[model samples]
Target: MRHFNHLLQRLRKIVAVALLSATTAALAGIAPAHADWLKAESERFIVYSDGNEGKLREFVQELEGFDRLLRLRMGLTVEEAPPRKLPIYLVGSRRGLLQVSPDLAENIAGFYMATDEDIFGIALRDQTVNTLKHEYAHHFMMQNFAYPYPGWFVEGFAEYYATVEIEKSRILVGKYNQNRAYWLQAASWMPMTELLSKRPLQTARNRDSYYPLAWLLTHWFVGDPDRQKLLSAYLRDVGEGGDPVEAMQRATGLSPTELSRTLRRYMRGPMPYQIMTLSFPQPPVTVTRLPRSANDLLLLNQRLKVGVPDDRRPATAEEVRRAAARHPDDPLALLALGHAELHFGDAAAAEAPLQRLLAMEPDHVEALQYLVRARMEAARDAESPEEAERLENEARALLHRAYRADDANYATLLLIAENRAGGAGSPNDNDVTVLEQAFTLAPQLGSARINLAQVLMFKDRNAEAIALLEPLVNDPHRPSSGAREMLLRAKGMSEAEADAEEAEILRQGEAEDEADGEEPPTGN
Candidate 1:
């Protein structure tokens, strides 16, 4: 019996070791066969290649930076995983526009957009960075915020920021949205009350008019009237403690719903007179190429990937220090060193390399964001709340800089607007107003539509949700299967009925799967 107990103990010890090994491997990202890329060096960004990997890596980096900045700004440092790897493909020849996804289209020079799991796809080199920035904003907001924001503010802000000034050209970071002109051509202004209460679908169908109106309206808040006063009042009402709708009523002499109607009526044109003129000098040169290369720097990266377990990975801070020394100018290598130090839970070590990356690229959003987080994380580790708060302020300031860089990034705007809705601490008309704006910007985005539908449904508007879902079910080309399924499930079908239908489909699918030797998906 003593011998038997000894054997059992030995088995348990072996199992524990194996489990620990597995966990470590997983955390180190060793399981993904394609995660490793050939490292290279370039001026704009440290190039990593799995063939066109630079674009995706830069995208991820910028996104990471944006998030870190926001967290630093907001004083909320939630742990997050590295963003899923997004693959970018370069077109040797323009075969029309590459169909990046079901919903997005892009030319070789412009960019294409699509998402799978956490992996986002960008087709163009130039647009990849901006698109990543925009999408990451969406991902961060959805993950962190408690509630959804309004449509106008969401899309308007996205549009404002999505405009990228590259060389002499304005690259639209969001959609081209040619329709903004139509809204500009629409009649005079609407009351705030009516505008806030408008439905998303209704707004989308008139997006040409809606987009511009939203831009103008947002411009009004951000640029027009007594800019500071209007913003202070509006933000206070929505972000602090005032009612958004009531604030509008007080400020503009119209209720939120009434403002919606007035905007519609005012949608025709000119807004009586030019409220503001946004003018700027163009860049002297067109940004020719967003380059990607790093042969010498990547040698370490390749070794890290394929070398034996003990032989691979920098074993000490000194090794990381040495490797980073060899590739002094490579941001990725520096970031890797920083990431390694951060992994050891040393904020100071992490901050050093991250700050190095920032010095090279001031607008490096990902580094800025993560550096902020690391700084705060380090401060927190050092048990200094005041330092963390200062770091938070710096981070938020960085986001504002990114935000100010381009105001058209609807996704970022949506994040802020949504925050305002929930952060205001009360249910009022502002939430509805903001959501309506978001609906216009991303009409095809199911999440925003769902937000609208849910609000209506909560107000006992099941018919409205059904109404919204009905057109989408037959879309045949819905971007998300999940969204479609939700629509079907929301159609008031009994479980037994759905089960019966599913069983028939499953039986058919099984026969098909058997013939093909493939299994069907279990929809969760």
Candidate 2:
């Protein structure tokens, strides 16, 4: 059951990538290119290039520096590095890049694919560093923060970090992006209401202004002392499921019209460099070579291309299995095989390779997570109840271990809460606590909200359940039928009864106000 939840996250990523591919295809008017690729591994990234090792190595160094700068600026203090290495595909030429992603070739220098394990990117060699910095800014934020921020903020923050400049001994942050500044100067700005809305900008023209405007707003928020507290308050309110417009109004004491006017004036003014300089320690570069064979490259390419609309994952899985068989001790091959089997084949097929990978690298979070799922699946098919119970216990123990490994993981917390709620017995109080924490961590997660609502309904806390369900009832992406049903059940009342309930609550409030010697008269 936990495995299914894990798989859903992976599938969501895949679907997102597929949609991005489709959007890019529509915009570019070109198709995806298939080509032979080579792989280079760094401490933080796996560089897949069309045989551009030198430039790829430079790109990796730039990425490492940018990563360090981001950590310093964001105040993240991780004792160990991330468990998984990000994959960066460096296309040798513009033509090569177009073949891979026409949309990126047309509109942007590069793009990032937020897959399950790898934070993937594809770029031409000329603009590798710039493109990587932009995409990696997005990756860094998503990796560090559990809650979903406004789309505008996400892009704006990325644009803010994307202009990092690395020199001989110093790294520069918050450097003005000339390209974005130009865009802001040339284009008409979006209304603050539309710009700050949760919905993404659909048109390319809107997007052109969106990035620059986002940068400007984020810059002002961070740079202006007057707005810093407001920004913090806005983030907190939004994280707690408050309406974005209301949150903004409450925090800033300004309406949308006023904000737009102020923002326009700010943009028209002379923009400063706004640079923050810090000493950067040059780390020694280390490179690992991935298995470079026709089959190995093919399998890897397939794995990287899994989210594309025409992705042939079954063939990729077979290729991965063959690659793993050929290079039996290759951790990459094993990991790919395990993931492919888990997604495409049954858990039984996935378990052996994942187990082998785990043996080689115990702290591999993805492997640990997948293996837990595989074990649970095997337990479900166990010959006897005792065997099934033993496997279930083992799966639960692994889940706890996974949580211990990364308590900040919202998915792990959600999974624990889900498993606890779905147990044969009544849901536990601890489960409710975990669900609440998960909800706090990722307020945008509709499934988490729905599940928490279900738990609240079971506990007969209908008002709380109603509060949770109301926002999600209209969510198109998620199945909201259950939520709608629960809403109806929780707030079950005739029209007259609802009116009476409202009147009674208002009367009680008015009576209390009168008792405190406060005037309660109000106009409708």
Candidate 3:
């Protein structure tokens, strides 16, 4: 098995290299170009495009169609208002899309990426409609379905929806995908048993073979009523924790050899398309043409700098401030400026922009949450006790509003837990519960782990604290001296000795913040 895995990995690498070579050859004459981006807002989508108005309209129409078809076919009820809107970026050229994400550009038409906050898409202008439908299908499945779906089913479903046809008043679905058919015709098919049992990594390793084959199999299953029943039963069994290969065999009552022979015959014959036309009332859409500067700010705001050091953060903040100044009334510009100020540790400076944003969008959850932090910082810096109390009260009120707007916000939950832990005395039972909830929501967040560990130590749950702190202390990306000190205390150091060491660390932190003209830490 180890040897087989090694061979598979090597084969994947070779295939990847060949694909990249092909893509590079195809894109030889394509030069990267920048364009002014425009924004369009529908009920469920916020599309950023550098394309013409007609192309943008087509994109909106196709997305609405995809949205309707996915919900209808998947037996999902339509919601009056979706909880979250997906953002789509339509770059004018393939080169422009590459500029947005160079690492993923090779041989990719488009992609959908989900962050902690939202799911979004980036696609080339020429392929905007098709790519949006394809990526949105994936996003819809992920967001709607809780159970783990097979990779073949997931990609097949996405490919099935990718080929959409928009008519005058309706949209056509399940159109024949020529690309997949071409690949299917060219490649030798994998045996049904092997394909059904393939893990995600294995399938990904042979995607050129896997994707087209999966699409073909899915097309065959859904096109024929008897096969569709078998597929449904197989999926049901798998969802109920049955072994997928066994489930397939039981559902279809076919041997592996028989299945392989049937699949080959199915692929060789003229394929029947299971096309459906769907019509639904789409919500009103609002389109706006943003300036080039605003587009740049939008990209900057969305860009993730996870392990990378960002020395230009201060300069970026300055540029965002200038943009905010020029477009003072624009809520997005103000929101960007507020985030920039917060990133740069100027919570006081963050207040005005955030407040301005709130005035424009009163129920903005993020703005409300940031305002809480900003107010807390101001409270810490308040010279008078009365002023401090007032600011704290205001911060607490804003936090309540933020919670009302979106209680599932992990950051807001963390802040509430931290405030509860830091106030008056040690963390209480409720504080521990909230911290645990935040940790559960986003276990990857080191700060949440560290904060929870601190509370665990206060509660004399040394074992729990140590368990939480060990991984964080060893993590190279997250250097937490506080966690290290807390770990020592959790391991049975004297409280006075631990306090002295922690105080020194806090003093150093304070000095660094002071040198950087940053506010003192307010236990956030």
Candidate 4:
């Protein structure tokens, strides 16, 4: 119902073009003749998928930076043979997870902690850095030593190390993400014993609590002297194949059971908290006409936005409630309330309003989408495993409904494809089907096209992929840098040749682009 504001419109245009050019170029490139490694200097691995040169370079840099930071913080030495490399997939949309695991990707922006090997993906660039850091922690831990470390410690330590503090803001990466504000919020203390004993599947199901619990436990161990020493000892003992329970008893002079209780008490006690916020301000609200006879819905969406803005003071909540009551059946009102609750860190509070709206208007696509998100948020506060699992399932169902309602929603489709690709596969029939489906839906959605090309490349169908990208590379309207790089790659030209071509093209285009003073077409 919201109108497309200038900012959103601008972003959409930029992202669309950027994505198109990037994918087009990727598919245009031919396999290199040299045996030289393809990865950026910083990363231990290189990804050939999605043919987006700019993105690939960025990924390599970030991974390298993360590795450097970890080496400094944890006193790790990058091994010459860095175990097996993890293939990191960066998708342009959040809902693209659905194309992978119909249920798991519905609510989360990124995913890891899977049973199968070779499955990892991160969506949304802002979240990508942290997610990569967090997953890398897991990869490092698993590879460095055979420590049967408790889940709490494994995930907790990862959270502590993954945190990125910049200037006035601090972000909790994985297992425990800060509140929507990026501010630390108090959680119902979960017992350490409970954290350790829970299986990964259980943890996955009750991610709301488990995520934070991992963070809190890690925070305690790293910040507190006694706990920190004991954790170090625990890792050492576990690495030696000693009984961790006995090791805990010896190291801390507390039995595993006692230590667990102490951890529960520690978690229950308050720890230092910080507020986390985004670099970007909240997106502007725009009103658009509703389809068919949903004019009332348009008005409803506007009033809801009026009720809440970036600075969510108490007065706004009261105003929101008042507006909601005025239009009980309004889909947008319920959607806004759901978003507000999510932002406020009260997932439980959001679920009812969103659910009610869905019940009243099953076809409300936005409402259905948010309803799924609301349930996932509520899952954090679920009192029991069954309840948490139920909420997660419910959320996934709602998301699937939204995705099915409009298969062409490129954002959702991208997430789905990325999620699926993260899991291990050899570009099987199913993967080919999904990738083709995604490519068909939005030819200009460069991310998907690139992903398809990557899959095709892996299948040794490089010629086919190159054909897909060649036209975009030659297109004068394509973003220059991305297109030139992709064109070179598709043609199997040497790097020097490619760079020369790119430089010449840039020299000719710089004047025009500067005169336009618009952002270079971005394929976000």
Candidate 5:
């Protein structure tokens, strides 16, 4: 069990957009002298930090600058933000970060999680900002382009932009990755064939070489204008299942050994950086210091709300409960306690604090949503039909109230749709509209996309559902989020391509339908 949990944490490091940090001398902490937390809001991010206000403001400007740089690179003309704002917790130290993700590796300085419910990033502020920037680069990639990129290219692309310098005059990109310089010097070079053909390797030597080599390869492409065009074509082919090594050789007109030789020589001299002199628009940043009512509970709330290992959650829940008890009037404390209860089961226990929070702040979107979930889950498990109906009715009432409070709240809209999706009847047009709105609000949330697809297929809108499932199945970071199974069910792809277990589940459903003397629905 311990080994399995360790493996799970390692898996989380990769999938959670976790940032691995090298050793560094301890710099002065970002925390302010006072025991207070600052919440900074900008166009793209909502950052919480127990740090100097000036430093945190500068930090946010750098973040905004990076966002703009990425947009400029992609030629995104509109300055409109992505669907949802990413909440980032700039934990003041490495130890502070560990409180957010206890089982995560010690060297992992930062991480972000995009769960079905929400998205957030957490990082230690002691090191340079490269770690968070690299992880955010991955998030940016996930948001914009989600083709089945080869693992090497995915990491490489992030690495290329990882070492950023937001200067007064200009922004510098394509800078060298000084973090892995030691690994690059010490580790044996991976042959071009091995480098180009494989996804990502975990062997000690391969691990040492992977990031540096990938960054070098990516830099080589970025530096040469003509090669950039060829690289695009090569990636397209690889996305369509072409052999990476073969495609690379075809694109560059060089054999594996020759290409390797050229890359080595290309790095012999000091590498060039692409400096963009574009004006970075400074978005308005609002920083609010938390009142003592909430300030004392911020870290504990963040630790619980961000995430924790399953084994530690029970203990965490106990702590939250105690905190809530102490600060009975504090909304943050109550919200955290309620979240822990709902997340760890005992939906009944979740209702008290959530209800308490709602009574204090009646229009609180999160509290309303939590209360609705508790009621809905209780309805599901209600032994008596009368109790079930009563619970569901109350849930619907709360959803209506929640909608009135904030129609733009995606979680509220999603909950509204889900509240009706599990009935004996099929989804109505209204439910479909709600789901679509939720999807538009947070296409980054896998659940929103999946829920909409499920409803689309049910409505025999197979084409639309397939359109959604294809990119989902092709997503390099999270390919196995039931998208392929969904595609198979919609007949988006062939039965031969579908997983055997998925096929069996469908066959079982058909068999059950036949036994029940009903015609099984057909897929397109």
Candidate 6:
């Protein structure tokens, strides 16, 4: 959760708030009231659904099957445990997806939010699953292969896997994503040069064809035996520092124009998919029905977790308050209410519920976290130095308590790193160690990585800083001027030169981002 997002905002007042990525969502806000709740807990997932119990159980098994399919193909053992149990909220139906994201973009069915230590997704259970799988594929890549894969293959690979068909005893993969069928035939396709070039094409509306086309190209390479080898070779060359377009030509011996024609012909023909017998059966699952009293708060908790746009926050926050009041003694309810309060920019208001939660469960990890955030924020606004220091000390103690309860929690480690290093002096070795540990726990978390890189740079460990910033700079989803600046420092550039380079990168990325409706990538 990267400090559950809300805590990070509090840190923004003290330190630089340079997140690695920020993608716009179709969702605007939420109004909460949930009943008929069921939870399906597996080793790698905790899914909440308000659908039929039998159907929900089957969905859980299918998801486990998909995880196995991914691992098996990637040369990993199927039985190994995942890093953490991902929480998924499979809302009831298509109407439910829209319920969460009323202004959802055309064809988008779901979304996922990832922090360094945790990730969660919201989608409609009994509806189109292509986008759900697509989002999970992105998560899988970020967790395992956070490599500097070319921008096209990043989307292409996920698109290729998005249509996976999970069955009881087997799985089907590489199927053409029918979700894009409408666009493939009717939408305006991008130029061959635009498709093949490493630079992102600058057009938001025209990007509609991007998904289907990327899927087609990936499918083409995967279906042909020789082309598959060529694709692997293309990846190898890119990994070894070849230009993506040039590497494509070197590996396949085809011009972009010729390749585009070949793809157009290929698109008109039947698609290809591979069927494999499942070597891994479904994992065990525990199902639980949430208490009736906790119903409304349950959904409210999920809505807050996903977030609400500022324009809609007040309304959603009020709903959260009302829901918690209905269950004053409920710790989970208090936690959600506290989260809503923090996000609504009323840290003081968050205290009551959080205090209630702590009084009941003194060691409640999340409650301790909310209190830390609230107190620090209060300190930030204190009337005098004495009050500020007192509040800060109290916040620090709560942070330590949170660590003792779950030391491995990335959020706690991150909070510890911030508290230790936020002052005038440079961070000591303990601070560096804590930041490094947080990075290890959530390599995909942008802030922790950036914080650790800064510490290393401060210590003149430029090589370590460079290695850490490389993937971040190369990740398309994570366009950070801070990362580029750090990379420049790590590479021994002058301060003036780094600043100049960062400005140039931002100028370029902003243009592409505006046109393509995506978070800009780190630029050279």
Candidate 4 displacement at residue 366 in angstroms: 41
199-232 in candidate 3: lDDT tens per residue?
3322212335667777777887877889888989
**Each prediction's TM-score against the native?**
0.34, 0.59, 0.63, 0.37, 0.77, 0.79
By TM-score, the best candidate is 6
Which 10 residues in a row give candidate 3 its minimum summed lDDT? Answer: 198-207
Model 2 agreement with the true structure over 305-355: per-residue lDDT tens digits: 434333555765675677667766566667777877877655468878888
Where does candidate 3 clash, by residue pair?
Answer: none
Report the candidate with higher lDDT, 1 versus 4: 4
For candidate 3, what is the TM-score? 0.63
Best by lDDT: 5
Predict model 2's lDDT versus the native: 0.65
Candidate 3 accuracy as lDDT: 0.67
Taking the tens digit of each residue's C-alpha lDDT, what string does model 5 give over 21-47? Answer: 321212223332234778999989999
Q: Residue 286's C-alpha lDDT in candidate 3?
A: 81
TM match of model 2 to true structure: 0.59
- The C-alpha local distance difference test score for the whole of candidate 1 amounts to 0.45
Least well predicted 10-residue stretch by lDDT in candidate 4: 280-289
Q: List the residue pairs that clash in candidate 6.
A: none
Please give, for residues 64-134, the per-residue lDDT of candidate 4 as tens digits: 54554455456676434353345454444543343333345345776553221122334444455666676
lDDT of each: 0.45, 0.65, 0.67, 0.51, 0.73, 0.72
lDDT of 4: 0.51
- Identify the superior model by TM-score, candidate 1 or candidate 3: 3
Arrange candidates by lDDT, descending.
5, 6, 3, 2, 4, 1
Clashes of each: 65, 1, 0, 25, 0, 0
Order of models, best TM-score first: 6, 5, 3, 2, 4, 1
